[model samples]
Target chain A: MNITSVPFLFLFLPICLLFYYLIPNKKSLVLQNVFLLLVSLFFYAWGEPIRIFYLCILIVVNWLLGCFVDGKKGTKLGKWIVFIAVLINVGSLFVFKYLDFTLENIGFILGQELPLLGFTLPLGLSFFCFQAISYVVDIYRGKVKSTKNLLNASLYLSIFFKMTQGPIVQYNQFESQLISRKTTWTGFCDGFWRFAIGLAKKMLIASNIGYVVTDIFATDTASLPVVSAWLGCFAYMIQIFFDFAGYSDMAIGLGKMFGFEIPENFNYPYISTSVTGYWQRWHITLGAWFRDYMFYPLTLGPAIRMRKFLAKKKVNKNVAKFIQNLFVTGCIWFTTGIWHGATWNYVVWGLINGAFIIWELYKKPLKNKKLDSALGWLYTIAVAFFTKAIVCTPDMGSAFSYFGSMFGLNGNSLVSDTTLFYFREYWIFIVIGTLACFPIYTKIKEKLVNNSNNSKKVKTILYGIETVALLIVFIISIAYSFKNGYTAFIYQKF
Target chain B: MQEKIKEILGELLIGVDLSSKTLADDGYIDSLIVVNLVSELDLEFDIEIPFDALVNENFNSVEAIEALVKSLQK
Candidate 1:
């Protein structure tokens, strides 16, 4: 069930917390882990009862394989086990996620209607499988030791907070906490506060903007005005960032409540001056995962090997390295795009991102020392404004048309009543969400909380005010949730 | 090796001189620069840095890069 839902907020979470705290065993956390596992299973089952079976089987298989893969690392058996794990994990993902895309393409090519397996993708199957693969690969690499404890492995793979909408925490990151973490009052308070903020962000900000996006997208783009087109796309940027980032905040907050220190996902991504910087900030964990698992292995492994071979053949060193990097870059970004969805739009979006990043990579040394950061920020924003439309549109042609409409090149008016209405209604959300995208709030919070000159009484009053503000935000968010609006998370499909 | 590393870094860096003993001390190389440096060193030194070898200390300075390359060459 969604964390924002009434049942989850009022029933599941409270009951889960009650059982969790009451179930004793202060020192040994075996009982705690099991309790979490059972509750998490119930959570998963509540959403996708069919998917939970697959999830359980996958977890068991990985744990079993992990038993041998750790000690025998680099040996034939260890290497093979790791290979099998990757194949099974990634292979299942490919079949479940991409099989339809492949079949549809083949059908067009062959001039025949192919029978398609209309599969309802198991909830979080891609994420579940990816995490499992990450675990097994870590074991083989000896980054983390394999464990006999099924509960430990299970908990790592199926932690309730991050299971669906993920920052994709690595295997070694919080596994220690899963074993023996000391939950503190401070941690609980921090988690609650973070959860409240994320709830407000999602419920109040994302949900409100989402309505504007849906209305704009639902209107035929052929007649959509230039200003309306731009506004709609920008609204999407706000909707998606707050949506995914809010989910990440909740995940991290819940992890904190469990005394697990999950990593932050977003760090003012809009402030990034470059596409590379954007990737580093936006969906930080996903970028890291691809870099570590896919990009590095591809680059340092096969791509480097090929480049070296080319260099041996008397190819210019710089040229060889560039070619290899470009080739590897293509693969990494293409895979990244596919990971988002089984759509050509996503693939092109991914490619555009990759192309921009590679362009920046080459442009690094050539950057003028005197170039203002505002110019870079403007460039980044313009790029996002154009490219993000592709993610919102159904296909590449529509994305291109939306761009044309934004420029008034698609026979659309410069100003429209719809655009003005949207601006009037959503000005507050747009203002708040856009401002929040910067580091302004974070900076102010840091200065206030970290002001050492403030007396204890002053600090206490500030803290009291902050706590009340957070509660009010939480209460308002709950009201919005109960207001029966469109509330599905954007990233749940991915 | 130090001189050669300085030369390579000089080319990679935008405006800063590589005279400082430590690159990080002067805020010369961010994480992106380090990745580029890894590729440059990989090609120049002809050493494939295992993913595990890409660490902060190894990429911290001119000397550290030189040392990392020498060790990898062995």
Candidate 2:
């Protein structure tokens, strides 16, 4: 069911695209919307046949809740409705995703075993739940009105391109497109090129480097050499970015092909000079979601009240403000950490990011822009490189052991045979993947293709070359896809 | 009111230009700064800026902020 799989690329997508375009564009898109809804449901069912029913129930519940909130807008009932909607969305998420983790922790604390109810989390439960919450909350906020049409709501929640993984498009951002959109030949061609690029990134770069990362991480961390440990961490850092961002690009391109404009999820995050800047670029929609839905509400509502209370008690103004900021930042990072998984390592990873960002916020503003940026880049990369070890490891023990190896604290040698082997095998992939993380290729392509001074013949030749290049990339990616069988996107687990 | 708002912004965001048209959009004033600014404005004007008013347009520029405060006051 993965978009990169043979069946999806050769069969499902082609069939879906053919049928989707067969429907004529009219003033009303009910027929198209209905068709997409059915296709999306089928896509989800392909993987999680039983869970698709649960998804349908959630869609219906959220749709009704949205209508109710809209109907009761500006009333106490509206607030309560939105609250209940959040509870339902979050409650279901907790039951499916976090209940077992919670139970295990409780059992540990009590020194007794507890019977655990194991539930397989539905595909994209985290993403769809967030989308559902945003829909109801936006209705209550009057930012967007609820749609009376159930098909449109269902399509919004289960759109095949964004259902499993997302740029997490907000309801208000997508509501208009659901009503009316145009599918142009130019858009389709652009989308195909973008999809090809994403496929190449995933197949040619991430999948190739991922094998080395897996091999290194699987080795005994206590004996893992310094070079091998660092190589593993660095390779994982590259693997995750290309894996998730490539999937995002494919999703966005698919949306474009279908005449929908999904918001971008990444913005060359590695180029960022600070943790704060990095979050703003990476998983942009999720950060914006947390900011608007979680951060702002907590800060503006409770944090403000707390600050006022502290001010009345004669607390120093800066001290009070710092406390408020600290409280808000702590809450955000804790939730962000746990949201990634029910793992403690992810929790620590989130908190580490939060701590650095807070330090940056409170640190004295740098006066020299150039020097500050250089230092910031170094600081950011170092932090990211270390924290990525935590993300890639199974637990804190393994993470610490891995870190020990990385820093030569484990009596590990600086270079090992395994490290040399990995380098010899994957040097090209490592170099290309590292360079691809930046926007250098995009810049070069833009300069060559978009320079107005280029003659018409030259431009035509450039386009021809570009088309051939994309075709080659697409063919190679497909070959890799067939060889690999089913390489799931890393983000799909979340 | 404008002078008071300007003084507060200057204190919170030192060295940042106040005349820029897209302060929030351009990342000059991020979420942390917005939180600080909101608390300061709440204390200074004794006006609670509603959550819905926290959009980028309301805080993208000094003039936009002034207008938002003015309208909220009414």
Candidate 3:
């Protein structure tokens, strides 16, 4: 069930909170963890019960691997066992996520129909599977001690806060927080405020804009006006920011409420002045996870090699540096895109992003950094918007068609009959939605909160007003939830 | 040595001032600048810093940072 759904927000959360608070203070952590796990299992099993068994299998196998690695700590054979376990974990992901896509493409090229063993993708399979792989790898690397408690480890792997969408919490990061932490009254207040804000963003803004975007995009191309297409795409960009950002905010808020400080996932990304900066702010935890665990390690190898070569003056440092950087950057983006889904469009999206970033890096010697940042940001946003159009499309051919219409290159005139009609309908939402992406509201809230210290009366008045505003937003969001027939979370498909 | 470390910390902190009274005793460096400072120190010195390194026991004063840097240099 979506965190935004009525049952989740009104039913499950209230019940959980009531039980959580009722637990004796000393044993609260154990009680809270148990409640969260049972709820998490129900949450996952809500729509897809078949996938539940597979998830349990993963939990058991990975838990066993962690135990095995911990058991053979001093033995030389332990390393190889860890490797085999990790390989099997990763292998499962590779096959399930990529198998059909690979077979279909290969079959097309080889001029023969490959026997398609059709498989239904388990919900959040890719995300949780990666989480499991990271857990085992961390244990093997001695970054974290292997948990002897399988149930606690299982809870860590399938925690409700991130079971569906993820910041992909690390075992080490989680273990520290999960063991002993007291949730303060202040923390509960903070989490409640954050969750309420996210719910409002999703229900009021994102859901509304999404309707306009979906309406325009889902219409037949022949019936669609050119202006409508642009409007739809623009609306989509806004919808995605609020929808995903809202979800991430709620997840973080939920984590906070549960005494786990889930990392911030979005950081006013729309205001970023460069593509790299945008990536830094957007899906922040995911990007950092890949950078730390994937990109840095890959780059470090070549950097060390270059450091050695430079010590002897054996290689051209500049050339070696460029090649090393290019390879790492390429691989990072390739994985970044592929990690989103098993689609060629996603791969192309990654390549396109990598290419832009590489070009930005290439021109660094000649270009002014600030000017390049501004231009590069514009270029990146433009590229990203169009790439998202590709991502949103079902196939490559239609993506090309969409791209064609975007430029008015397919003999479509800007001032055509269709253009004016779309502009008339969606112009206001398109403009307003774009403005909401930055830190305006956050800045406003900060100002009020900062000024709350000036007077007791003033602080009370301000907080009371803010609470009322939040309550109104919550009510409106609930009202808007049924606009579409319970839109299962976008990240749940991952 | 402590003064030198404070100067470096000042440069790293940008608009914020680090004082003798506030630097170690109070929590003036609790927010954005601390994160940046921690990363810069780690990257500049090439050492893995446990999260606790930012707190009073070792990083409580400028002398602490300098001593930490000197030890790493060794």
Candidate 4:
């Protein structure tokens, strides 16, 4: 269910929170995990019932394999067994997420029409499968102890907070917090505030931006005025940030309310001055995951050789270093972009980011502070949003064509008078959506709410006002929902 | 070594004189600045820094980074 849906907002969350908190202190980890497992399963099954059985079977088999692999750690045979298990999990993910694209490519090459299996992808299959593989891999590496308790393992694999999209928590990072965290009144209030803010971000900002962007993209490129195309692209840029970031905020907030501390998924990525900076801030956990797991390992050979070379000679460091970074960074971005989806668009998106990073790597140094601050930001945002057009479009030709339209090079009306038509329709949303991705407002609110010098009376009055404002925001979001079908979270399809 | 770092930062970050800025400040070479600097440093100095080093001593300050670079040079 969409996080903004009235049924989810009013009924499911409240009831879940109540029961989760009300569990008596006597329940074992087994029971608590089982409770979480059941809730998570129900949450997934509510949207896609037929997929639930397969999802459960995957969870159980993977959990057992993880245990088996962990038990075998340190032996050569154990290493082989774990490797095979890891391959199985990732292979399943690849099959589910990429099968159709793979088959179509094969069909194109062979000049034979293979019947499409038309497999319905299970929700969050990519994320959960990765989580499973990481858990086993970590165990095999002795980075974490294998949990004997199957239910605990199951909960780690299937938690609702990350099941849809993820910060891709490491098994130990999650379980460590899970075992020790306490539910408190203050914590609950904090979580509730976070949830409400995230809900507002999604419903008020993302939805409105989605409405206009969807509308503009729906129009044929030839008919779309240049100004309208640019405006639509701009709106899409803001829409995606808020939509994905909002989902992350809600996921983190939900994790908090459950007394779990999921990783923060974003920083203020838009303000970054470099493509490298953008990756650090955007989908931070994912970047870190790739850096730790993929980039470092792949570059180890060259990196080691480079280190030894540097030790021996006072040779030119910049050129050698740039080459090393370019290679590693190129692979990181290439894999990162493809990791988002199986499409050529995602591949291009990744390469574009990779290219930009590589360009910055070897280009003349940028030192002008005034230009660096404003122009740098504009350039980074433009590059990101422009390439995001690739991420949003289905194919390369359409994206390049739309990108051409952005420059008014496609012979469309350079200044579509109706450009203001979209501005009038989506400007408020664009403004709010852009601002919502930053933490400044939330930080400001925290200072107001937590200032010790404020009188209790003043605090109560401010809290009351804030609550009322949030309620209204919630209502407006609901009212908008009353207008359309539930817009699925984009990441859910992955 | 300090001069080398200055040249590198000046080249990578573009506008700032690393000679003037106190490398003591975290902003001296922010994360992106650090990544660029290290990529250059790795090539120039031929020292491979593990990713975690960026979080630890490598980017903390000029002295810290210099010390790490010198050690790696060995």
Give the clashing residue pairs of candidate 4, or none. Answer: A310-B46, A317-B43, A317-B44, A321-B43, A366-B14, A367-B14, A367-B15
Interface quality of candidate 3 as DockQ: 0.07
Among residues 3 or more apart in sequence or in different chains, the pairs in candidate 1 whose N, CA or C atoms overlap within 3 Å are none
Give the alpha carbon lDDT tens digit for every residue of A1-494 in model 3.
77888778778888887877787656677777777788888888985688788888889998888878865654687768766766776677777777888898899999998987777677777678777877776776677888887768888888877877887777777877667777778898888888888877777767777767766667654334556667667777788888888888888888778667888889887776656657767888787577555654443444444444653575564564455556676788888888787888888888887776655443432246677567766776776577777777767777777767666666655555545654576566566667778778667866776777665676687688889988897777777775544765666666
For TM-score, the strongest prediction is: 2
Model 1 regions more than 4 Å off: A364-370, A445-459, B16-36, B46-48
Ranking by DockQ: 2, 1, 4, 3
CAPRI quality band, candidate 1: acceptable
Task: Candidate 4: list runs displaced more than 4 Å.
Answer: A26-29, A69-82, A110-114, A301-323, A363-365, A414-421, A437-465, A482-485, B1-74
lDDT of 1 by residue, A91-144 (tens): 788788889888998999999989999876777777788788789888888888
Error of 1 at A350 (Å): 0.8
Candidate 3: stretches off by over 4 Å: A71-79, A219-224, A302-315, A365-376, A413-432, A444-461, B1-74
Between candidates 1 and 2, the DockQ winner: 2
Interface RMSD of each: 3.3, 1.3, 9.3, 4.6
lDDT of 4 by residue, A305-405 (tens): 66447646765656656655666777777777767888888887888888887776556644666776677678888897788668766788888778778
C-alpha TM-score for every candidate = 0.94, 0.97, 0.81, 0.84
Candidate 2: tens digits of C-alpha lDDT, residues A399-445: 99998998899998999887899999999999999998999967886
The regions of model 2 sitting more than 4 angstroms off are A445-452, A455-461
Q: Give the 10-residue window scoring lowest on summed lDDT in candidate 4 chain A.
A: A24-33
